[model samples]
Target: MAASSSRSFAEVQRRVSGVHRGTDPEQQLRFYDGWAPEYEQDVTILHYQAPRLAASCLASAIQGPLADALVLDVACGTGLVAQELQAKGFCRFHGLDGSQGMLESARRKGLYQELKQCVLGQEALPASSGFYDAVLIVGALSEGQVPTSVVPELLRVAKPGGFLCLTTRSNRSNLRYKSQMQQLLDDLEQRGLWEKVKVQEVERWERATSEQEAMEGSDYISGVVYLYRKAQTVGF
Candidate 1:
């Protein structure tokens, strides 16, 4: 990669990260809603793969009827995960996102059966307990996004023996947040809420890299995805 290209990518990363620099959820919503129009392009530029990689990982381990399985897609931005999962044979879907703009984009795809707007970590998840056959979230478990406290909520919404998959970036900026989330996951498992199924660290997860690692041709990001199954009986 040329020095000029590296510099250009770094600038893009800076602007993107700046949009969600604060803890104010409303401001972040506005930024994300406005970014909906160009969200795919920007993620493409960054080589985002949480959607596809997570879909593939879950799809491979899926059981029962694929065409009839109910899925709750948390933070279903632009329905990218829906698209990927649709390709893998899942039909029913419910999408949840905080950004109405992003929900509109996802709605246009005609993939989800329902779409709801809820600010994660701040608001209660608008789903019944043990309702979804698969409850999955991606790209929203990192810094400046959802908090680690929602781990139990995600598990609560998933049916007993159902799967819950989530992904988080494994980069310098998100390492601390990742640690907190991991501890929550472990705590949930200990309490017999869920059981760990699989964990994968995907290399070259995305491109365009990060501002902290800006260098010529150094544009591949890495992330980890975790899969778990809700316990059939809590505290049993």
Candidate 2:
């Protein structure tokens, strides 16, 4: 599929809405496969900033040398997260996404040292435990995408004192899922798995794409970026 130079908001929203309508991971994968060519363009049209926001938080929270750190980019569609981190001096990255087409697009950027295919929430992350200096998942932790259960898996892959950064929209549609995700994050902190590092909430996450949001007269919706540090000693 060739990329289109011009993409209208209606077309972009329709594509986004189509992906959201997918009922299962396989279906979503198919949607993303077809969407890979224009994914960047569409998100650009939306002024999507989750990748940038999550990368900023991760960069700020990391403790050691950025170049040497092995960062795991989960649900890393088209290498957007890596692009942002690369701009911040982070060099090493391993990416994982379910869509082969999406991975192919990411591969062209030459940002990731490794790229694997895994359906998040349905499959275990294909990486060694306690290896990465930082792990991140952005724009994929909402109601229909990755479940909160995979958060522990993110922590499991990070080295002690490493950081795990995540982002989710806080718009009206995602409030319930966000609440559940936050509860799990809080529970993990209490369980000695990780400690809270930062929670940055932005009012202009992206231009509103849904009709309901437009009807409400809001130009942009809200979102959040969460950063956590893995404990030095984690028990299970």
Return the top candidate by TM-score: 2
Model 2: CA > 4 A from native: 1-5, 214-217
Global lDDT scores for all candidate models: 0.83, 0.88
The true-structure Cα RMSD of candidate 1 reads 4.2
Which ranges of candidate 1 are over 4 A from the true structure?
Answer: 1-11, 214-217
Candidate 1 TM-score over all chains jointly: 0.91
Cα lDDT of model 1 by residue, 123-191, tens digit? 779999889889889998878887777778888888888899999987767778889989989988887
- lDDT tens readout by residue for model 2, 1-236: 12345989999888887755527888888888999999998988898889988888888777668898899999998999999999999999999999999999999999899999999998788987899899999998987888888998999889988899999888777788999999999999988889998999998898888866542557898899999999999853
**What's the CA RMSD for each of the models?**
4.2, 2.2
Pairs clashing within candidate 1: none
